[model samples]
Target: MTKSARADMITVLAMQWNHRKVENLHKTLSMRFVKTTQKAQTEVDNLESLKQELNISLEDTEQWVLEVKQWAATDSNQTRHRKRRRLTELKKKLRERILQYNTIDTCTETIDTEAACSLSEDVILPWEAQGDMVNLRTKRRLFDQVMLVRRMEEEKVIIVKEMTQHCQNLRQALEKLDHLLHQTKDDIRNQSMFHKY
Candidate 1:
């Protein structure tokens, strides 16, 4: 082969080798990222499971508290006994709920760590000159998605708050009705007693 041609061939070979090395490096990095992403996903699942359990516990506690309060206010032959029983049960349930909340908080800490790691995983390096524009675009897209998610979460919170308020109003109305009924009964009993005398 001519000297110039041989030199050209050597140059091409070096370029090919460099390209292969870059490709292999990218592959290695990609595999590592996938593993990290999977770990993050597992953490997310765990967090969700804990959150669901917490919600169930919260609902149960709320119902139990309501029942306890109702029993406390009830005027009946066994009111004292029922109130004591309810208070004892509520105390036990409250302790259990506190334990569950502690567990959930621990899980949340783990989730927060995992989330931080996951978010950092996709972060662009300042020195990444070639892909800065593309990275910026990607960040913008992710920001939009995050904003959308926040809006949805806010809407759900509003709905939940409205429902809770409505429930409270309903409970108050029922309590008022019960009070009026009790007053009427007492008034009738007093009148009957007076007439008998």
Candidate 2:
């Protein structure tokens, strides 16, 4: 073959080899770009999922706080009503005791000195026996009720404090999340505006 023809053939072969290398490089770069893009997209999706999870958790916590408040309020009202009723019953008992005392006083005034002297210290009056029994029972009942109410109030106070603290923490977390969301929205808006300009 002529030298000119041989040189031209070599140049053509080199050009073909360079073109193959460029094509391979382009394909590799394109694949890498696609893989990177998909990885970034997955990361974004994960972040979105995490945000949703956080939101759901906050909502559930807030709901629990609300339910606890409702329960506390209901229990408190019921306790108040029971206390009122107990007070009213005690008042009634007091009135009955006063009437019994007055009746006994009248009876004693009419009692002869001989009969009064015959009744020894061991010979208890019927009214005294009945009043003592009733008073003892009422006293025991009142003591038990008072203790129960005190315990319940203590529990209520503890629950209220815990709930208040939990609610406050939840509120702060929600506020922070809201603020972050707003900042993200503003950044996105600014980026869009920047792109437009």
lDDT of all predictions = 0.56, 0.57
Model 1: pairs clashing at backbone N, Cα or C within 3 Å: none
Q: Give the TM-score of candidate 1.
A: 0.32
Q: Write the per-residue lDDT of candidate 1 for residues 113-135, one digit (tens) a residue.
A: 23222335454332343552333
What number of backbone clashes does candidate 2 have, counting pairs of residues 3 or more apart or in separate chains? 0
Highest TM-score among the candidates is held by which one? Answer: 1
- Considering every candidate listed, which one attains the maximal lDDT? 2
- Tell me the lDDT of candidate 2: 0.57
Clashes found in each candidate (C-alpha, N, C closer than 3 A): 0, 0
Off by over 4 Å in 2: 1-142, 194-197
Off by over 4 Å in 1: 1-132, 135-138
In terms of lDDT, model 1 sits at 0.56
